[model samples]
Target: MKIIISEIPKEGLDVKLKEKVESENISSTVIAQLRIEKLEIEVIVSGDLAAEVKLECSRCLKDFNSKLMIPVNVVYHPVEELKGEDNYEVRHEELDMDFYSGEELNLSNLLKEQLMLNMPMKPLCADLCKGICPVCGKDLNIDKCTCTITKTDPRFEGLKKLLK
Candidate 1:
């Protein structure tokens, strides 16, 4: 969605965007609400974004679906006005402030950025997920493995003599 800064009225603008994003790593239909308020020469956009995404479990490597909701708040100022000594700093009231160079504001880029930021570093299907057995390549979650799970580091072997 695109928003023209000059077109905004005194009452502000309400925008709703819903569409499927094309990416192999992420599949989502983003439902976003954007409220644009013109404060002086700046455009303040604030809303909430929700989506259902497919994520791979880090432990079991299984695919699963999860829902996410992220709050969107940004202030766009002209790039020219934000350069040099007169550069704007993010004040206490405007923590999500940003600068825009173009005549139009592109919301798609912001939504994509937010989605990337909201992704989990380590996705897990379950907290207690028993991952695949490394020795025989068996799924430990489904069945018990006969393989002896041991960590025999060469450095730790010297410590065994002290116990003896």
Candidate 2:
């Protein structure tokens, strides 16, 4: 759905979208409920989105599926304002702002951007994941490995040799 800036009605536009995005890390249907309102040269988009994402657990290194619910609140400014400028420094209030080119705004692209931005840095399958074994290379969560685990401080090696 492409929304024209100049055609926005005074009562605002309510959009319900179910868009499929296929990318490197994500392949699922994004469901978003957005409200778009244009105020002079600025456009405000506020909504909530939900999607199912495939993620790799950082600790156990296993593939898992998780549901993500993200809240979107973005203010868009026309990119025409920065056409002749080489570089523009954003202020503190401009951190959450986005730029729109021309009169059309591709809603599918915006929903995809919101999905990527809300992904967790470290994904976990479970809260108590035991991870993998350091010695024999086995998943500790599946079964207990027979390898003996020990903790040795490298700095105490010389001190232990002097005592011996």
Looking at model 2, the pairs that clash are none
Best by lDDT: 2
Residue 135, model 2, lDDT: 86
lDDT of 1 by residue, 17-83 (tens): 9967656577798999989888887888899999999988888888989888989888887788866
RMSD of each: 6.6, 6.6
TM-score for candidate 2, residues paired by index: 0.83
* lDDT of model 2, residue 122: 96
Q: Candidate 2, which segments miss by more than 4 Å at Cα? A: 84-95, 148-164
User: Each prediction's Cα lDDT score?
Assistant: 0.81, 0.85
**Global CA lDDT computed for model 1:** 0.81
- Give the per-residue lDDT digits (tens) of candidate 2, residues 64-121: 9999998988888889877887887554273368889999888888888989898889
